[model samples]
Target: MNHQSDQYYIDKVLDGQVNMFSVLVERYQSLVYTVVYRMLKNKEQAEEVAQDTFVKAYKALDRYRGDAKFSTWLYTIAYRKSLDALKVNKRFVSSSDIKEIGEENIELVEDALSCLQAKERKQIILDSIMKLPEDEAAIITLYYFEEKSVKEIVEIVNLTADNVKIKLYRSRKKLYSILHISRNEW
Candidate 1:
């Protein structure tokens, strides 16, 4: 939707036009779910957290001041909600069972990157991202996948710009390392 259209919807949402918020929801559900799934790495939990993120966003709609883009605000909620889910899940699962995303995706890429196939590279990148720390993963996903800026990331992640830069640098390094280790440079 256009900026003017979204703003109009936001006005509706803020003025007790609760159901109108679904337009916002339909617009951003995938973005929110991707953030949650990237962080939690568990489909079920990601879905739950994504649902909660929208619910929380709706309840706080009146308080939104538009200091940041509405998308940024939604992501901030999803990121925090996903982190909370991870903390709770961390207590119950063994690390290995959690499946390091880097390694899993690497295996997927092995098949796709070859002359005979094409799905491997994406999986490799995704796996490497999954292996990153939560903050790094969020930065990579937001910056690379969602095409958000450092400023937007800073607001959503509640980090300073410098920290976001550092995280992005480190994340790129980790991703390169995975590629290097896999001997699949492309």
Candidate 2:
């Protein structure tokens, strides 16, 4: 949505045009869900958290002082909510299709394994990202996936520019290793 159009929608929503808020919801639903899904890795949990993120965003809309872009604010909520869910669950929830036999004995079945091919390499990279430390993952997601610049990322992640750069470097290396991609490829 254009800046003027988004601000209009937000103003309307704030002025008791509650139903109109769905437009904003529809616009951002997939982006929010993808962020939650990447972090939680469970379809059901991700859906639930995504829903909560929207609801929370709606209830807190008045508190949103327009200091950041709507996309950034929405993603910050989703990221935080996903982290809360992970903490509550006490373990990372892999996709239901994934099965584990032991610490090092887990294996993806043929169908699931196929999803890790070159075509699905991005998903594999995302899976590895989900395993990263929360701050690092947030930086990677905001900067790379969301296309937020370093200054914007600093605001969202509340890190200094230097720290964010170091984290990004370490995160890229870690993601490359976890995805089994050659460093040169990265």
Candidate 3:
């Protein structure tokens, strides 16, 4: 629930109450999955990577330095694992392919987006996110969905704070373009 509680669980697990590790997994699995899925965009691969992320965290548990939040440390593992998977799969989207939507259409698209049901809106956003290049999507997901600070994201993604900020900005523009185009089809 809180960092202190997370530390308590970590200490318990380190003390040989290994079952307590499940609590850590349960608390963060979905968060880790979201990050992986956003990058890989494959259900099976994402699930596999999520499992790997936990396994990695468990194996490296004793090395956790406590300088970062447990979630941040866990995310760092997830992020690296996802990148490793990406390297193996060689699946990548080009950011250059993300066209910039006209400024005039932004408001119109926002209005159309608002008219959709929440579930539909969320699905559209998720679908669009899947179209982004891996790094951009990860940046957007971490900054917006996971509510991670730029500094925290830097640790996870191995990017500078300014790079993360720029990616977040550009990713939003790309997403807006995707949404605007999708709105027109409705």
Candidate 4:
């Protein structure tokens, strides 16, 4: 596997070396699919959206200004495309009735999950996140799994910095609440 800056491939693709685009896809395919899956919560739909994300990126590659990291730009496309998928499919679930998480923060959830095997813990965490609304799910995936900063998330989600913070905070609280319930269901 050769290592090269993302821009190196982007430059090559722009120079009419179309096959170079495969390198970018190979680099980001999993992450793009994961983010899409988290938001859509349906493997088939997420797969379509993820592929569309790459197609859109390829078509618009020339518009990329190199201001943000390539991954961030790709994520922005993934996030929006998933939102479009949700709109088209009309399956988005809202968490408005989910009563206050009350007393169950992520720390407590982590403690509860400590007994599970690592794989189970990770899947449980991902499942709990998938139960969230699309926006919050995307936020949590970017914050925890991808380690994207608030600024990066803001760019990806097209939200204000403060808005992203508020959503991230509420998403954490909501996530722990979901995990708390899951623990009890076991």
Which candidate wins on TM-score?
4
- Tens digit per residue, CA lDDT, model 3, 1-186: 545488999999999999999999999999899999999989999999999999999999999999999899999999899999999988776755455322342334446766767876777787788889887888888888999999999998888889888898888987888877777755
lDDT of 2 by residue, 1-186 (tens): 544466788899999999878988988898888778767777999899999999999999999888888878888788889889989989654433222112122234444445445645565566567766656777887788878888877776667999989999998887666554322223
The TM-scores of all predictions, comma-separated, are 0.82, 0.74, 0.88, 0.90
Judging by lDDT, tell me the better candidate of 1 and 3: 3
**Alpha-carbon runs more than 4 Å astray in model 4:** 96-112
- Model 4, residue 83: distance off in Å is 1.0
Per-residue error (Å), model 4, residue 152? 0.5
Predicted structure 3, TM vs. truth: 0.88
| Pairs in steric clash, model 2 | none
> How many clashes in each candidate?
6, 0, 0, 0
Q: Write the per-residue lDDT of candidate 1 for residues 161-181, one digit (tens) a residue.
A: 999999899889877776665
Question: Once model 4 is optimally superposed onto the true structure by TM-score, how far is the C-alpha of residue 114 displaced, in angstroms?
Answer: 3.5
* Candidate number with the higher lDDT (2 or 3): 3
Ranking by TM-score: 4, 3, 1, 2
Candidate 4 local lDDT, residue 59:
99
Per-residue CA lDDT of model 4 for 68-135, tens digit only, reads 99999999999999988888888758665343232233334445666666876787788778778889
Q: Pairing residues by index, what is the TM-score of model 4?
A: 0.90
> After best superposition, candidate 4 residue 75: deviation in angstroms?
0.6
Let me know the TM-score candidate 2 reaches against the reference structure. Answer: 0.74
10 residues in a row with least lDDT, candidate 2 = 97-106
Ten-residue segment with the worst summed lDDT in candidate 4?
A: 99-108
For model 2, what is the error of residue 147's alpha carbon versus the real structure, in angstroms, after optimal superposition? 0.6
